[model samples]
Target: MDAALFAKSLLLGLAIAAPLGPIGALCINRTLERGILAGLAGGLGTALADGVYASLAAIGFAAFSDALARIDMPLRLLGGAFMLWLGVREMRPAPPRAPAPVRPRDLLGTTASTFLLTITNPMTILAFAALFAGLGLAATSSNADAALVVAGVFTGSMLWWCCLSGGVALARHRLPPAFARWVARLSGAILIAFGLAALLTALA
Candidate 1:
């Protein structure tokens, strides 16, 4: 159908997901700590959420999106609390030893954790709405066109994660245990600060 429109939406998705925010930090941390698969799991979760938001925007679900926004404060609070907990868990001391086996549950856990983290920010929908409107793909787009664009969004987001995780996995062997530990703690501190800021904003 509209290949140009689909390509634009794909780029939009890449731009949205490219930011090195909390999710990016988490993915990198997991990649370094575990392996490439673990990192990709985290990315997959966020990508799925992006797809969900993009789908809503493509379908022009204005009313439903607005309804989610109404509880934005609560969602932020929940997300902040979870981040704090996750940061604390990451900071927990671990013996310098061999890496543990990557279980199916661990991948699922990473996926679930990132998914929860991404979806809590209802602002993502607003972002998609604004972006889609700007691109003239929200209300005016045909169902077929919207579907293609949404698929492109998912592909673009997933591609970013794959690249990030792959890079981190390659570097994992170069990092010493002590350095990895420091990175973990530093990431924890950053996450804690982010959590506090979000919590304070919610209270305000």
Candidate 2:
């Protein structure tokens, strides 16, 4: 494995995840509502999805790519609907209690939900493919190097999530319930808007 290529892939992963999109919002909201563990679980799910996409891109399988394209519209619609439901649930008033304790089942559910959300976006594979090609890794990298790149991406993505969730969790204790509730509502609104946009794009 080329250390330099792996390092570059790590940076690329960080850059890809650094954008404050639906995933970021979801992570923050989960952290604020259920604590850092929950947020990390969500991040883990996202990282796994990222790794999956990276592998697909690295392999450059036309059949796999074509399959993703074929179901793109359905995936978008499903993702949008799920987001709408999640946003509505988030908008509800928080009960007068501390953030819920993270149970094993809760973690599983959180991870699975975020994984589903991340995987639904077929664009992620395109983004990875573009980045790999732009870096010339697609044409030159060996199988081992590609594996390293995939690992690097997963590591980098998880690292970012750790930082984000940790930062939010640290501040969570200081914020009053009302303020937290307000943030929740705002995040919910943002999520709804994203969902609507996704639906529109899919329809268009």
Candidate 3:
């Protein structure tokens, strides 16, 4: 096993995911409002998306990359529409309710939503392509190494999510309901803006 390659890939995943983008904001908001399970589920979806692109790059799947690029505009539009809808829905003030056990459907929906967002972002694949090439991993890696690298990327990305959700869970108590509501509003607005930008870019 190429342990060094695995470690590098893992770190790369962590580094990529650590940035507080729209997805990060969503995860944090979910953690504060819905609980750790919701946040982790959302985060896992993003990890899977990252794994898909990283795997394609590491294994040099040029055909799939080209195909994705071909349909990028449509994908962006769909993702943007979904994001706008979600943002508007979330912008409403959350009603205070007792914390209940997480439902399977909720987790599934949350994960699927984030997955769609991540996969539709054209920049994600390009980022992986550039990173894999710069790290000399795109052309030189074997299938086995590629598989390992992909696995590492997923694991590392999930690890970051776990940490983020856990940390937020710990501080979940400190945030008052009013403050949480404000956070939700801000996060929702951010997501809406990002969605609008993506839509405009696609239309352009």
* TM-scores for every predicted model: 0.88, 0.89, 0.91
Whichever of 1 and 2 has more TM-score, that candidate is 2
What is the clash count for each candidate, in the order shown? 0, 0, 0
Q: Worst ten-residue run, lDDT, model 2?
A: 121-130
**For this target, which candidate reaches the highest TM-score against the unseen true structure?**
3
User: Model 3: runs farther than 4 Å from truth?
Assistant: none
Error of 2 at 2 (Å): 1.2
| Global fold similarity of model 3 (TM-score) | 0.91
Comparing 1 with 2 on lDDT, the higher-scoring candidate is 2
Q: Candidate 1: where is the Cα deviation over 4 Å? A: 96-98, 122-130
Clashing pairs in 2: none
What digit string (tens of lDDT, one per residue) describes model 2 on residues 70-117? 987998898888778878877884764667778999999999988887
Model 1 local distance difference test score: 0.78
RMSD for each of the candidates: 2.2, 2.1, 1.8
Model 3 residue pairs with clashes: none
| Model 1 Cα shift for residue 158 (angstroms) | 0.7
lDDT of 1 at 163: 90
lDDT of 2 at 156: 85
lDDT of 3 by residue, 24-90 (tens): 8889888877899999999999999989878777766576567777988997798788778878977
Candidate 3, residue 134: lDDT: 67
